[model samples]
Target: MNDEARGAFATRGVGLAGFDAPEARGLPPAATGVRVSSASDTVSRRALAHGQEQLRDGPVADACSALLRAAAGLRETDPAAARRALLAAASAAWSAGDHDSYRRVFAVGPCHLCGAGCASTPCARGCPEAAWRDHRIGMSAMAQGDFRRAIAVLEPRLHQVTPRAETDELCDAGSVALLLGRLPLARRLLSLALASARAAGAETAVPGIIAYLACAELREGRHAQARAHAEEGLVLARRLGQRNVAADLSAVRALVVSIAGDLPTVRAQVAEVLAVAQPHGLAQAAFLAEWAQARAELGAGKVERAAARLAPLVQPGARQGHFGLWFLAVPCFVEACVLSDRALDAPEMVDLFAVWADLGADPQAPAQLARCRALLAPADRSEELYRAALAHHERASGPYEHARTHLAFGMWLRRRRRPTEARDQLRAALVGFEHCGAVLWAERAGAELRAAGEVAGTGEAGPLSSLTPQQVRIARGVARGATNKEIAAELSISIRTVEYHLRNVFAQMGVRSRTGLAHLLANVDEDHGRGWELPDRG
Candidate 1:
């Protein structure tokens, strides 16, 4: 075998003779007297090749079963080769979404010809093929939404391999980081992966890497950059005939276009994505496409349609655990449920969001959980929950999410006959959506503004108008005679964040002193019917 193929087989835990030397390399020796004759080796190689060919062609489940059977046949004669075959089988099981089978194969150490006590041996220590075994287990964990475990298993191994191997490891680790909402880490890791793939001449890996980077940028609210990445990834995916990667990129592109209010393009892209993904059983891509469809329906004012589309995704059952992207879908699902008067159907999903939020690793989860709570909150408690959600979004620096909270809060205020406050929020949401290229949300905010009897862009723009949602909160706190520490406490933000926003507020308001800021805000509030209460300086 060539070096690349040898590395690939080795990485799959398929130990070939003369390559993976356990005793010679000072690793734990395999069972004694379990030698494979030359003919047996040839037959084993043929079986491995057939299994790989089947995987490349399709029908991954059948291929996995065949590999497992082959491994069983070789277990007594050649434990090392059997272990390799088992690794491939476990990986195939994972790819086919057979979590049960994968767990069955990987949850314990392989039985070296000495079946007894083999389970007690540490897989990593007793097996030279531990890296591949751990990688397969990590991937299965990721599919099951156990991101913490996936990261733990995969992160440390990124640098302990060839560039080609590092490319694959980086991609996996970066994907987990992205799902965990570690944007900077995800970006850094994916960038390195892309560079490594290029250095290794692994052109086929580039599209997948770029697709992940697009997702990271999308969550960061860099819509333009995300679109750029998605577009390039799509082109490469098509050129390489990688339908799965193409589907992923298409779904991402559809989401971007849907947010941009291009309903026709969104619809077409969704169709294309689903068409490719469903036939291949690409659950992640299908989920993303359905999510984009629901978002498009919501944008077009078809709340019921949106709710119907999301029902299967959010409803309790085995399906929930099947899609790792479900966490990202929670906010949209909650909005749909509430708007369609089906809020009662989502109590369980709300609980799920709460659990994810309690984990507190993903930056977006807390804000999304707060939004779901706000939607489900009683009339007396709704406003507080909305504000809390907005504060969480602000602290996370998620402008897109902050705008979504603003839009929801504005609609609630409008229904409560608080038009001035509603207009303020609506205007902010409009500006935020527009800035982020969320054309559909921008239009929705504009409609809400008109409903509040305010002409878009006609209201007198105050200095505070230019401030971000977070800065405005800080400015209001200062105008109310609250100190920085108090503002931080009230907003659930760091003291440093409060101080930073206060500085921005002062600069934007062109004020040199707190008194000056308070005085100016008072005048602006009165002039613009802001309805903010200015307390005595005391």
Candidate 2:
């Protein structure tokens, strides 16, 4: 190729040396008919090797560009070598956080490094190049907020990794799992990643893994544990000068504090998170911080403010598509919208949440969807939707959400003039909120209870109070006429377990039949005045 033509290719970030002379379209030949020799090939190979070495040690983007140039130079003369160089370039670009470059290079087609026809066989098992291929695909999917695809790409290869696999592999898999609402699997994988990072002294990996663990724990309703993990991760990230990680950890802390009803602390933490995240282009951190700030506003009874803050986030917008954490914000946004008397805004939010509900495979999605529907549904259907939401929330094992559902249901019941039934749900909400350290919610529940003319702690112990949270849930299910099998399926537990819990619930509530159980639970306050007692099976 002529110097001008080669220079043009280089300007476009393509290496021309690897292009065969015949295939160098739009390029003029050298001034003289110069024949390429083996000596020239050797020089090109040396240059490619040097680029590869730089990829391993130097600045990633520069190394990536150099490697891509080398790959282009060898593309026609040495296809296999060119493929290897391109793969190295893609890897370097990904490592440098240039996902666009990675995708651009991979769009050239499957190479030996990614296996023949790799893009079409994303889920193919046992391919020799599966690990690297899936990792690249998974990371790309995650960056695009296509978490279901990311999980599908990563979960299969997780067990195949040897002990030598990088801690990031585990961290990425765990994070995808958590986003999918596979909480148990996420917890297990994140725990392993944390252990692996600590053992290998991978200090840089520790903070990100810990941040994920904190999120998992938060979803699982282990508030204190979540806070501790977030605090530790935040400290480590700041100490390591990992500004993005610190920003993410700060956002996590904001969520924790918001749930705990410390609005002031939540606001402060969100400010810190946004200060670091927005300037650094940390989209995930900024999204989370804004979500947490909205939650804080909601908890503080600033309904209009919360609704305004959350509206843009839940609506179809630039920020909404980039962050898959929208699932976590939906319930709060739905409530804020309804409470602010802007129920018209709910349809779009509900539609967006419904899309996630369909794709997320999260255990909590059904309950959250039901809750959103309850908020948007007409008065005639709202009660049924609320009941369905509560049942699903209980089955999903999110105590904080379950409590919030109860609070919503209690408020609804109170408005319907069923104060006695309202008090039952309010008391349950109060207990759950207090257990989760959601002080504001607990106080709200307490206030609702008082407004129902039920003196706090003055009535005889309600039969529901003696039951475990699980039993109370089962009792409510039975009251709603859900069979044990149906309850089992919804909760992701065995029918036998549901049956056993129902029996305990029946015994505790002094009811021998489902109908009696339903009646007694519905009019629980009637028995409260009579001091109903369970017959001890023990």
Candidate 3:
């Protein structure tokens, strides 16, 4: 970092964690998750030959030559001419086996310096085509959201540095590392690359590198440092007139603000970003910015508005694999849990936490498992599970992954009737999430304080205080838009029995309609430690 950037970070009490050597490399992955073990036939070889023959000369140059030819055939004034040119060039490059050409013509145009030295530069004749081919494929993989695949392809290339190399391999390897959750390695490698880019005056690409460093801080919970680097990168991007990079920086800034709980500012900045980024057809930035804006609304306790905003991003059949969308669910569900607590409405709210934990656990390591373990009711029954999950998460991504894990673990212990243990876990989680600017998440920590004094705080409304499991079950069924008949049928009881339970539920929960029944009962988190355990269901 320059003196200014370093000073800015120091001002925020942030420091570079310093570099450790690279981690052990894993095997390269395929373009898609679908891997084919079968060998290619002679026909595939012949097709590659024919395609290469189409561009026997400079691969990129030949691809451009094909595009220029296609565009010549279209009328100069034709509105569709640019698109037609692009399509035709892509087709020709495919035919010519020009992978670089195909990507330039077909893919989102960025990373402009990829093909500068794919082959052996000092060799009397360049290295074999297959040797250079994987890098071309790797670059394309990185452009896609397939981070695992990108990691695989770049691993061998990173370690294969030789005398004839035109560009350092560490730069590309570091880029992959950033995507794969290895932040320190990414920062170190990217910083070195940025220095070289600056010295060479490749000003075009510096913003991307700076953005990477900013992301390192974002991951580590240094919001201020991240914001500073992101802002600086934004200025550089705009100064260089790099719209794509600018859009990207703007989106990250919006995310930072949202995470910080600065909703009003996030809303305004995101609107500005969307307006500019959309016109440029920067879909990733536009989409992510919109999602982040909704996230801010969710954090601000504006539930309905947040749900509406998240609709597009989280809609069913939406192109999946959005990490942002997944993480945003944390606040959304927590808010739901809050509303449930306020209204005493949704028992499902508490259960939803369990579901979320189960969904994320198999893939998470031990330390992270601690977070999942938090989902269980505090008791001896789940302590082993919680500890096991913690062990897994910590192994996978270190202990300090996010505050939710700690806070949730505390809640789990509290539910298990381990109040002191719960208190300690909740306190740590509260402090951690608060420090990270995850306000909505951090605020939930106060629930533990309320939990500690819950008995003294609540008056026993006699009948309601003594609700039965069957009654709570029937109440939830009614609340879920189910008719008495459906509830009875599902519970394998008579309709009269269902009606009887419903009356008891309504009287106990204090509500008329299913909506009121469910909404009001969210107040059950107040059941904190009341010995109000439901009978075990078979």
Candidate 4:
């Protein structure tokens, strides 16, 4: 683990108190009437039923404790039932937003048969129900920054082709997958879990699963899908009185609308989420809500206000956002800092972002990192960095992020007296924003284009603008004397795809050769009152 990761955990007061404590072998002190012994199956079953009843009624903390105790009582008699009970405990703890209770239940201590906490795969003592033991150890390893071991241990348990596991079990795996940055796996698992919940008439489980699925889609850049799922989940959650799940869904909706630059909707969703999240200790929901607000602020050009708003969340402090979510917003925070001329205040967070980028969890991390470097780099170095960022964006999925990069690069070009190139980049950004329904950002790009001496959406229908965005990119690559292979590499597409686009580019422009294409582009540049000059990437 990196220093930033360690610092984040330390700041969050995350410790293995329950994982190593000997008292973990017994039922929680607050949990009464649960007798745990080798022959307490009937008692354990009753406790489990009571705990489930508590989940539907009230006092969720008591339910978690009771479930944990029931799991212990059933451990020696029925391994499957014990696993189910433990899974229920995890669900109850999560819905209550009780992190401490979650940790205490899942971070089981030493094995009853062996002194060690089943640190080995099979447990040298051949402990009964070693799967759950290994799972607990793996979870603890993850909490303690040993991700490699955790993945090795826990990943296999979730590898079933068509998982028919219990709803809570699937939900647990889905949550872990998300935390590990395995977006596709998280989506698949959670989707299956949602189906299972619905089929079993587990209405109480449905809202939380939908919330998780929405979160997965949001991170994967399926914003419209995320909003739909979040909206559905929010309705169900509110109807069921599951305020914590409702808060999470509301936060997800806020984030989705924020990307579209809908400030009013963002503000409304943020208010709804914070009202529940802050009072219920839903740190994940609160973090997403704050991030959505900061992003809306940044999009609206309130850079200083955005920076100030994000400082407490990204900086190392007691009030820092949830460890899982704070890193996701670091790129935005870095942009706000750079735009506000508080660049020096961001290197630490950037270093943390570097750690996140290295994890390869987020598909857009590489591009965002490049953009951050471009923002921080000197003028002589920033252009190539911006180009590098654009190249990275070609391989990523987020249209909003891709547009942001183009907008930034265009602003830089315009400031450098490269008005022609700035117009091209700003126009692309405007198109991207429009495609994604980001009205405010599209307007921002339009204004930038106008400031660069090219009237936004009012060109003489230039040949280059007539081409599709992909075709324009291919045509530009050809005009720059780049080979098909080179264009493929730059665009993160196949050479065949580049060649196909290039053929269409030639036909659309009525050009017979590369030289003709180049000449035509040069003529377009001359029309802008300046001869074309190759960009000096150095």
Output the number of the TM-score-best candidate.
4
Give the per-residue lDDT digits (tens) of candidate 1, residues 1-538.
Answer: 1444333222222111000011101112233555667777667667866665454334556657777766765766666667667755654554454545555564544534333234323254656555545655554454344556756765565435344546766665566566455677777777888899989899876886888788777777777888998999989888887666677788888877777766678879989987865565555566777888888777655566777888776554566413334556667878777766678877666766665565444677787788788888898998999888888887785677788888888888876889899899988999999988888678668766765767444333668657655566578778878777655533334689788888887887899889998899889888878743212222
TM-score of each: 0.67, 0.65, 0.52, 0.72
Mark the 10 consecutive residues where model 3 has the least summed lDDT: 13-22
Alpha carbon lDDT at 446, candidate 4: 76
In model 3, the runs with Cα more than 4 Å from the true position are 1-126, 136-152, 159-171, 220-222, 302-308, 315-386, 396-401, 415-417, 439-443, 453-538
Task: Give the Cα-based TM-score of candidate 4 against the true structure.
Answer: 0.72
In model 2, residue pairs whose N, Cα or C atoms come closer than 3 Å (at least 3 residues apart or on different chains), thus clashing, are 17-73, 18-73, 18-74
- Ranked candidates (TM-score, high to low): 4, 1, 2, 3
Which residue pairs collide, candidate 1?
13-84
Residue lDDT tens for model 2, 131-182: 5555556544544445667668756665564445567666655665664567
501 Cα displacement, candidate 2 (Å): 43
CA lDDT, candidate 4, residue 389: 88
- Shift of residue 162 alpha carbon in model 4, Å: 1.0
Tens-place lDDT per residue, model 3, 1-538, is 1444333222221001111111111111112324322232233333333333332222323544644443433222231443334433443433232334344532322121242232212112443333334544443443333334545765565544432332234454555455455666666676676677777787765776676667666554567777888899899888876555666677778877886567778878888776765454333456557767766665444444555555444332344213122332333433333322322322233333333233221133234434333433345555676556555645453223445566556765664567788777777777776777676556546545345333333233444446554565566455556666555433334689888778777776567767787566545534543322211111
lDDT of each: 0.65, 0.64, 0.48, 0.71
